[model samples]
Target: MTIEKTETINITSPLDIETVEKLHAGDRVLLSGVIYVARDAAHKRLVHALDQGEELPFDPKGQTLYYMGPSPAPPGRKIGSVGPTTSTRMDSYTPRLLAAGVRAMIGKGSRSAEVRESIKEYKAVYFVATGGAGALLHRTIKNVEPVAYEDLGAEAVLRLLVEDFPLIVANDIYGGDVFEQGRAEYRRGGN
Candidate 1:
């Protein structure tokens, strides 16, 4: 099999539909701009608020949520080790978030088939950060502010300004899945 060169794209957050549409699974990206931090606990609260007709802390439209629970910042630091959490835990809440107009999600691991279908339906994308590169990833985060659910501590939602945050498009609006492709490639002895 022929290996194609991957183009690296620099993107700003609050990603527009047009920008998200252009991305495909396996594309490398450096995202710079605003993104929200959330994990499973936060997701549950967000969904619960929605269910009760309560206003969400942040608007979901055109937004990107990164699945992370960061450690406390050291002296004079914007953030600590802001690592991507395992995404599967948030799978149940994902489709609801997508329907609310979330444009992209950043995390690691494959999503459930239901979540993947929802992504395609909502024209959203899922991105994966290198699982063990939290320290490196933290460097890209220029600003961080707790936004909601502060009682949750590290699980509280945070607004983040990131510069050149690295990610790979693991699943895309067009139904591409990089993980499956990689596995297939390996099985065929192409990698």
Candidate 2:
């Protein structure tokens, strides 16, 4: 079923668990409004940007950062094989970003305890996409445009406009995690 919300979700954290739990895997979400884009290299620079007292490229408040490193797209395509990468690499930068007011993250796989704790302390949610589904994922992305950090190449940050982006709920404000849920549910021999 397609889950749709027309009103731009004005998320003012500390986010609530109930609100986050409502989201689930295979949900079709249209996230509008503002969000920050951070990859491995860019994240490091952001941490230092803080130390330098420089204004962040984008405000973290009421925003989400998608952890994806898109392949260089062929001409006439919005994006190329855009998919979520490993999340652990960003573990170190996540807490700080959360502290700065990031409310959600879109990526694949599990994150470290430090990141999960930050989610609880900061009231954030972690959204995961199925691995090895780039072709499927791309179908959900309706638009793509570059946003700062272009000098970093494809690793450059970008503001993507997605239409009914499909995703799974990995972690949420309440500490509910899909990665764990599946393990416990299937371990009992449900499969």
Model 1 lDDT per residue over 9-60, tens place: 8889999989999999999888999999999899999999989988899998
lDDT digits (tens) for residues 97-136 of candidate 2: 8887777888888899889989878877887766677877
**All candidates: CA RMSD (Å):** 3.6, 4.4
Over 4 Å off, model 2: 1-36, 188-191
Best by TM-score: 1
Worst 10 residues of 1 by lDDT: 1-10
The numbered model that scores best in lDDT is 1
What lDDT score belongs to each candidate, Candidate 1 first?
0.92, 0.72
**What TM-score number comes out for model 1?**
0.94
Q: Please report how far candidate 1 places residue 186 from its true position, in Å.
A: 0.9
Name the lDDT of candidate 2: 0.72
Clashes of 1: 0
